[model samples]
Structures are given as structure tokens and as C-alpha cells.
Target: MSLAETGISDAPLILGSHTLRSRLIVGTGKYDTLELMQQSLEASGSECVTVAVRRERLYDPTGRNLLDYIDFHRYTLLPNTAGCYNAKDAVRTAKLGREILLGLENPGADWVKLEVLADTKTLLPDPVETVLACEQLVELGFQVLCYTTDDPVIAKRLKQVGATAVMPAGSPIGSGQGILNPNNIRICLEYLKGEDPDYPVIVDAGVGTASDVAFAMELGVDGVLLNTAIAHARDPVRMAHAMRHATEAGRLAFQSGRIPRRLYASASSPEDGVIGRTRQDRTSQ
Candidate 1:
């Protein structure tokens, strides 16, 4: 059946306990101002957003928090462990995020985006520490959406440790290099989805622009999570709008099934319908 008839175009993305209509998951960081961030979020059409777990600004008596501007009812708040360099730190930050979300009465308070980096230079996740954190978090009853490298074995290990979603990096965080290794990303998706067709594989980083997001979606990833691509753009709000459309267009194209690659050219106009050329004349020529 055609994609239009199959209704895949209108399908909602199911991630763990949440069903989101929009596949784009943006971050709340690096924006010039909170108001601009809110405006960009509204323009992106994202149903879920990621926020880092950090200290409360209790020092400033009149200071407002990020949650003050965001409406929790409309968007799912996915708290992430951004600056943690080890499993212990990541676990502690995740627990703190849960506590903060619970205090705010957010619906998906138990869900945390886990990122345990190896160092500050590359910002690449440590596979060993990530697996350990995932196992501990799962045991602690947190729905873990793990940020990992593009290694298929590590992806499986994360899934095996009871992670809800395996988020493989398209490149380093905030690099804006786009998908540096599409082959590795594709292999990860294929291996993970082959195990469970409904499993969520979100491309978590290195999306420089709309085409980068589209390329990830075309590889059949369930979602795309990015920050710098939109937050660092010259016009963040406009880039958000572009991302919304790009994701939808890419998803539809994937569902439609593209034509197979070929070395030779195929003509659009029929050779049989030429008015000036008869069968004998064409053969003789």
C-alpha cells in the first residue's frame, strides 16, 4: 500500500511511556535569552524538550528559573545529565533531576536522558561507564534514554541493560558537523531495530542544520535530539521552523520508500511515443 493510504505519515512516535506527535526533541541551552528560547521552542513544534539538571538559583532573590517560562503541560521535560564525567556523577545528577521534576509535578518525572562523558575535550560518552549507569538507573526505576556513541555493540549493551531508548551521537555534542558517519549510524539503527522493531533510536548530537536532521530521519531513526543546530543558529526561531518541516518531510519520504540506486540513466519520456520516428526508420538509423 502507498504511504498516504497506510497513514504512516500521521503516526505518532512512541518512546517508552510517552506517545509524542512531533519527532523533534530540542534542548534548552545556549540561547541568548529565556524568552528567545521559549519562542524557538514554540516555533519548533516539538512535543518533548531536554533540560539539564543544575543548581537552583536560590542566591538571587528575584531570579526566575527556566521552568517559570516553560509550560510543563504542553511539553514533556526530559532532564539530562550534561556535565557528568563519570557513572557516579551521572547517577547523582539523574536522581536530582527526578527530585526537581517531581517537585514541579511534571508527568514524566521518572524519565532521564543519561550522558556520562569520558572527558571534556571530545565530550564522547564512555561506553563502560554508560552501561554501568544505565544498569543502576534501571534498577532505581528511572526510564533511561541513554546518550551513547555510534557503536552497535554498545547500543545493544545499553538495550540489554534496560534502557528505554538508545541515543547514538551523529557526531560530538555541539560540533555541528552533521552526521559524520552515516554508515555507522545506519548500522546501529538496523541492529537495534532488528532486535525490536518498535525500539527507539534517537540521533542525539551533531546536527548542524535542517538537512542534517532530515538525513538522520531518512535512516529510520525514531527521533532527533539536538541543541546547537537550533540554539546556536543566527536565527534560532527560523531554524526551529525549518527543522519541524524537515523532519516531517524526511519521515514521509522514508515511509514512501525511495527508488533503488542504479548506475545507468532512465528516461522519463517514452521512446515508443515519438511521432517523427517510425519503427523501420529508428531501426535503420
Candidate 2:
């Protein structure tokens, strides 16, 4: 089904001071070519896309850059501190991202996808470093959207440190495990929202398919941020489109509310139907 058919009214747009059209946030890594990346972005209807800044090969004389493929005007460029190991590196990378991508005038980047991985193999956020970086970033005037574990304490700490959003991983990055710890994630959501109803809880990473996206939303997650799932799909464009609709459907479902489950069977038939009749009617024999 189309995104419009999924009951996604245009009213509830996920914005960062300045409005972003699409709620689905995508990543710029893993696409075969620039054209493919553009196609996936168009197909996914993602208004916000991520770009990692670090020492890498450049296609031009201007050293390493992402400017060639990315059009900042078209998509909200969410530069991420993907490879940073400590608070110092994450903070430094964020500052550079602001300077190179956001420019000096827009120093208040308004949003940053904060990631401080402790281990290169697992790509898990180091709680100690992440919290330190979050505190520093928020103090620096950037709206921090931290990528963290599905631990209530960690999430709460991040929230206490002024993180605008806490993005807990469904599983390891690129693993496609899809909410490995739903109970923990739910607890995190409850803790943050209960503490401050306005805090945004986003599920980031390890979402494999549409169901995974729906599950996150069903659990009351505000939004989701993903990359490898779509980019590595056999048909990236199709997967992107699917993810777009899925996110909308999930959001709609959350707003619509769900029915509580019961132990015994409940009939939808009329209360005074034949099934409800007593044994007296069959005693003619």
C-alpha cells in the first residue's frame, strides 16, 4: 500500500526546528553507486539522510568529502559520529561536521546522530564515553540524538544529560536482529516517556524488514533510523519503498491504539444469536 493509504496524515511531520518532509531517515552508505543512492532516497521518501565524516578517500582535489553525492538542500543531512571511540573524537568529528557541512551560520546544527563505539568489532556504544560526549554536545548547543543500548539506566542517563532523543539499537549494527531485547527497549521507552512525555525514543539499527519497523512503532517508539537493511537488500529501491510504507503504517497503528488480549474466546456475533441459546431449545427429542 502507498504511504498515504497508511493513514499517515501530513500533519505530524518529524522536524528539527525546521520541518523535514519525510519521517523516514536513511543512510548514505552501502549503495553501489551515487545514482543508486539517489534512487533509494527517492524511493524511500526519506527527508533526512545520514553521512559519516572521517578520514577517507576523496574523489576530488578537496581531500575526503561527501558533498559530491549529497545535496544538502534536498535532504536534511544528518552527519554521524559513527567511528568515534571516545568523547574527544566524537566531539571533534561533530564540530568538523558542523563546519564542513552545516557552515558557520548554522552552528546550531539542531540535530546530531551521536555514536561512540567502544569496540570496532561489535560497534556497540561505550556507555561511559557516550554519556560524556552527550553532555558535552548538549552543552555545545547541538540537539543530540544518541545511539545507545536498550538499557533503561543508560537511556535515562542520556535523557538526564539533555539528549533530545535516545536511539537504542534493536540489535548490533548491520546484524538485522530486529528488536532482540523488546522488553528492555519497552522499559527504556516507558522510563524516558514516563519521566518526560516529550522525550523522543527512536529505534536505530538492526531492523531487517517491515515487521521489524512495525514492531518498534507498536512499542511506542517515536521513529527509526536505519541504513544497512535497505542498502543491502537485493532490491534496494523496493526495500526502501517498503520501509517507507511500513514506518507510516506502524506510526498510524500506534496512534490508533490496539485492543487488549483476553484469555478466553470472545465472539463477534450478536449476543442473542443461536450460539447463545440454552439447551432447552434442543430438548424436543
Candidate 3:
């Protein structure tokens, strides 16, 4: 049988109106070179990539931009309000990105990765401003995928505000600490998917390695959006491949169901099934 026949074919990730095959979303920054970024993205097998819409980020110091390296046709661009500190700037940046993508006729024109930071040091979301921007952007006909903290209540509030996808940070952005509190992440998953089971809740940021992605997936997150984890790796291209496979493995393990954790050991082979071992002898042991 073909590999796909062995149950590798799973349901696609659904975010609002977009049905995507790749559950991993990468970012378009931090690579040693633009070429490495392009290759790493290809290796990642991601359908969507987040791009910071800041002018400096949009254009490299060499005067060229992501448009020069990234093929918009091959990858859908999810424009993000990376540096925006408040609702107004975030909204404006989202609009500007929409305009740019609309001109390019890209599929991501109407959707965004909304990030409204509280400060540069922490890179945490301003919960108040995040909700405000989400509401405003939704009103403007943009599919806003909000970025927020791992607080379950805040996640629910973002969903209530009409966020297409609620992305909770795995930890601090680029901190590489992975999922610091799986319990909180579990709660966030429970709260967000409780009402709408299939609602897309992606874990964004703080992934350091492939296992981090797999761990987040095992927690039942719909997807993962990461950059530094892959881009800043010693071997970025190889790590990208690892992240792709990790996503698939994690999703498959979740679907297949795992054994419950136990303090005691359970043998794969039963004592009764052992040759030359009588029931009385086994019992005596």
C-alpha cells in the first residue's frame, strides 16, 4: 500500500474560509540570507507564512523586499502587525497589508496575523488592544487571526471578538522555552474549542525545536506558527524538514490515541501468554 494508504492522509486545517493542508505556519524573517529563508520555507512544507508589514521589514537594507525572494504564488502571505503597539497602528498596518496583497492578487489579501504588542522587551500582546484591533479588523472585512497570551479567558474573549483564529503564545516570543505551562495551554484549548470544536486555535511563538511543535500539536492545537525555532536553527533547512514531519507525527499520534499515563509499568507481553508458564506458576510469582 502507498504511504498515504496507511492513514497518513488526515483532515486539512480550516481557518475561517481557508482550508489548508499544512498545519505548520512559518515566518519570513531571521534567516542568514533571503535564499536560505526561501529554501527553509520550502522545506517546511507550509502553505502560509507570516510577514511583518513594517516598511523596514518589507524592504531589506538592499532596497529589495520579500517580493523579490518569496513567490506569492507558492506561499500565501499572512501579513502581521508585528511592531504595532496599539489598536490604531495595528489596524492601519493590516489595511496597508491588505492593499499590498490585493494589488498582488494574493489569496491572503483578506486575512492577517494580528499582533499588538504591549512592549518590545516582553513582546507580549496588549490584551486590551488586541481585542480592540480584532474587533476593528473584523469590522473592516479582514479575517483576523489574533495573537494573545496563554490565558484561557483572554483566548475566549478574542474568539468572542470574531477572531478567525486565536493564537496563544507557547511562551514569550523567540524565548525558545517551549510550552511552559501545558496546563494553561490545555485550558485554552478547552475554552476555545469547547463551543466550536473545530475552531482553529494555533500555538504561536516560543518554539525552539521540532519536538516543541510536536508537543503543542499533542495538546490538540489546530496549528503552530513559528519563526525563530526554524530560522535561527544551526541547520535551518534541515530543521524546517524536521518541523514538518513533527507536525504530521504529532497529529497522527493524537488521532491514533495514546495510552493513559500511569505510575506503574505495563508489559507488552502478558505473563499468561508466556510459553511453559502455567497459570498457577505465574500466580505464585
User: What lDDT does the true structure give each of the candidates?
Assistant: 0.92, 0.84, 0.92
- Candidate 2 backbone overlaps, count: 0
List RMSD in Å for every model shown: 2.8, 3.4, 2.2
Q: Model 3 off-target regions past 4 Å?
A: 1-7, 56-62, 273-281
Candidate 1 has its poorest 10 consecutive residues by lDDT at 1-10
Residue-wise C-alpha lDDT for candidate 2, range 1-285, written one tens digit per residue: 655687756445543464555657889898887778888988898888888887765566774345666667677778799999999999999988877665724323567899999898899889999999999999998888899999999999999998888999999999999999999998998899896665678899989997898889888888888999899999999999889888877887888899888998777985455675576765652
Task: Evaluate model 1: give its TM-score.
Answer: 0.93
RMSD (CA, Å), candidate 3 to true, equals 2.2
Better of 1 and 2 by lDDT: 1
Clashing pairs in 2: none
Cα deviation of 39 in candidate 2 (Å)?
0.9
- Candidate 1's C-alpha runs over 4 A off are 1-9, 275-285
Instruction: Give the per-residue lDDT digits (tens) of candidate 1, residues 6-53.
Output: 765576888888899999999999999999999999999998999998
